[model samples]
Target: MKYLILGAGPAGLTFANMLLSSGEDDFLVIEKENSAGGLCRSCMVDGSPFDIGGGHFLDVRDPDVTKFVFGFLHEDEWDRYERDSRIDLYGDIIGSPIEANIWQLPDKKQERFLHHIAEAGCNRGEPMPEKFTDWIEWKLGLAIAEDYMLPYNRKMFGEDLDSLGTYWLEKLPNVSYEETKRSCAEHRPYGTQPGHAKFFYPHSYGYGEAFIRMASALGDRIHYNEPVFSIDYDNRIVNGKYSADKIIVTIPWTGVREHIGLPGKLTDSIGKLRYSSVVIEYVPENMDTKAHWIYYPDPKLSYHRILVRHNFCPGSKGYWTETNLTRFDEDKAAEEGRTYFVNEYAYPLNTIGKQELMKELLEYTASKNIYGLGRWGEWQHYNSDVVIRRAMELSIN
Candidate 1:
């Protein structure tokens, strides 16, 4: 069967890579962008490479997946470094996974946090949470939930925590009482999001280099700047010309639904899927910080996180900061002569009923021999590893 792959991002390219390895030549990939690497792509900012769509760190725990990804480049193509992430809370810069590093706070702040932790049982077993907010409180207690998780999530997700479900809570670390106490007492690092303690990046180019290399290997199989005009699934026609027996799509559902019409209820359900956009400000001068990225939970700060690009690559002279706001104040950026890029769809939210709706949508698509892949198409808050794994799994199948 001739297969049609949609989008040439990591997911699409990885899937295509598998197809190519299997000697499958009939398949074709169509991408709206001229270049590969969807949100993971990076660009040059004044001779220095900077990530235009926030941070994309490579830290796959799966050995097989790691082998597959790193196989694309020579051993010397990438550089490895331990994660140097921190949080800026109440003007204090502390280790990340803030729950495990609260002891680093001042004496008064530590006492207050400890009292709250003790009262709330230090993230022990509790009833299942109904909303994302409840899940945070249950895992880290009211002190952390209010001080960081609640407000920070509100800022990051661009919605009330009560409205979002516990779909993505599994990503957050859930340290036990003993571990939490030990971390605080010893002032030792603890409870990092597993597999993120260390990561690798390209020594040259940017995070997107690997994907670009893969696309280069694929050559003419990918059609660039070819926006899909429509999809007539019943007749298996794409853009009124290309026809396929099976189709793999990596574009957003919002984009898909417009082309392939959906029923009112399904459309409405898919519409409920919310996303938080990002604005990245690329400062010309470097920020004097050793930490790679610092979370700004205080509402006082307009931006949420500041990512020092130089920390990842010494050649990179400056940093990039992200804000949830879409319409960036270009005037402010121009004053500092900082260039900024805005992405309208960055992080997808698992709003309440999202799981059920996504299930329904996928089932319907599968029935039509249409499969969805990637973060936006799948509408999950998946990391790069998860995205690559899904592509690998689909390729062999």
Candidate 2:
């Protein structure tokens, strides 16, 4: 059967590669942008490389996905480094993967956290809280929760904390009262597993190089700058133009439904889905530092996070041949007088009712031949590795 995949991000590319490698050659990958690697793409600016979509790291533990993607790279092509992330709260730098590094907090804050942990430990057998505030309070305690977690989450999601589901805690590390206090007293920050903190980065090119490599492997199967305006679901085709036996869509669900002229019920459900828009301001080389990623939990900051590109890939320096780098709004940027670029995204904002709405839309869409995957299409948040793994699973089968 012929397959038509939409959006050239990790999800679409993974599906395309899997199908082609399995001897299923009759497939096409469509991307709206002029190139692949959607938000993960990187560009040169004033002799430095900056990833438009924050910093994406490949630290997946899944062997199947890792072997398939990185198998092509030579040993020297990849650089494995431990994650050195931090949260910039006011002027203090707190060790990141935030929960594990609570000891970095001031003595008063530390004591408050310990008390909450102790209370939580005693109440471990009770039912977990449903709201985000309760989850943070229960997990980190009211003091830390109110001070950092809640405010940071609000800034990130652009919504209230109570709306979010507590399920994400599974990916986080939970510490007991004794452990937290001991770590604080000893001045030893709680460290996560080495594997979790370590990631494989391309030594020479930016992370986008990985996608470019994947596209190169596909030969003539990939198409760029092809914005699919419509899809004929009844006819099982794309743009009411290209005929295909099966369709795998990875674009925003709202856009997909608009193309197909979905019914009111479906349209209404899709409309309820909310998303956050990101602006990635790329600064000059001098601004680049050793920070892999910095989190701004403070609500005062307009941007949620800032990433340093030069630190991630030193080889990117060569690509910075141009003295002038493009800015998002030249007029405004000129006012500021700096070389920087920004990448914006309408990513699904997980609200209280969003999950349920997405579930309904996903169920409705799945009944059709089209398979929806990835962040916007699935209406769920996922890392690059997770997106690729899911796409691979769909394509391999």
Candidate 3:
């Protein structure tokens, strides 16, 4: 059966690759941009290549997806490194996975967190919180939630924390009062805590290089710069008469709703979805620092994160001098006494209303045989591995 895949990002590309590798070659992949990679694409600025949507580390623990994406990387092409990530909070560099590094907090804040832990431990089997606030209080207690979690989330999501659904709370690591106090008293860093401590990255090219290789494998099967403006669901076709036995759409759900001429019921709900726009700045190789990625939870900074491309691959230094990927105009950057290229993306914001809207969109699209996968398409937050794995599952089923 012929298949038409929309949006040549990771999800669409993964689905195409899975089907083609299975000896099913009658599928077409369409991308609106000049090339693929979507949010994961990198650009050159002043000879340095900067990931427009921040650097992506390939930390997926799933072997099937890992092998599928990086299988072609020669020994020298990939680098296996332990994660050296950190968070900047209140003039202090706290080890990443902030929950475990309570010692980084000032002594007063530490004592407050300790008290919160005590309270939380006593309140077992309480009714689940209704809002993100309640969940934070229940999980991390009042102190950490008010001091760190609340502010950090507000900066990241660009929305009130209470509006967020509590589904994501389970992903966070929880520590009891005694555990936190003991760890702090021992002066242990948060990095020693469990989950996602070790991650891998490509050694030579940026992470986008992996996707570029995948696209190369498909060769002529993939079509770039083909923005699908419309889909005719009444006739079960796309772009007004491009026929396919099956359609796999990986574009943002917003695009899908617009293409299919969704009715008022669906369109109204879909409109509630929210997203955060990013501005990436790629500086000169001379500006390279020790950080792989820096998280800016403080609201003062316009950008939420800053990443150093050279940190991922030493060879990337050469590219830093040739072009500007950070989207900052050379003359403008000079005027502002800055020297980096910047690129940005509007990330999907997972507000409760938007979450519900996304669920409706996914269910509606799935019912029509037009599977929606990936972060933007499904309106769910996901890393690269999650997108690839989900697409593989969808393609196989």
RMSD of each: 2.3, 4.3, 4.1
| TM of each candidate vs. truth | 0.93, 0.86, 0.86
Residue 10 of model 3 has an lDDT of: 87
Point to the candidate with the largest TM-score: 1
lDDT of 3 by residue, 134-207 (tens): 78878877776766677667766655666678886676666566777787898885434443455667665666
lDDT of each: 0.79, 0.69, 0.69
lDDT of 2 at 166: 71
lDDT of 2 at 87: 80
Q: Report residue 57 deviation for candidate 2 (angstroms).
A: 1.0
Give the winner by lDDT: 2 or 3.
2
Q: What lDDT tens digits, residue by residue, belong to model 2 across residues 1-397?
A: 3888888888888888888778889988888888888777876665555666666678758777678778555547878877877788776678776556778888877777777777772236556677777777776666667767777767666565566667655565665667777888888876566334878877876677778777778887777888887777666677667778888888886665444645578778877766665555655444434667677767665555666565677744311111111213457756987554444454566667777777777776667677888877787788788888898888766
lDDT tens per residue, model 1, 211-250: 8887987889999998876777676678878889888988
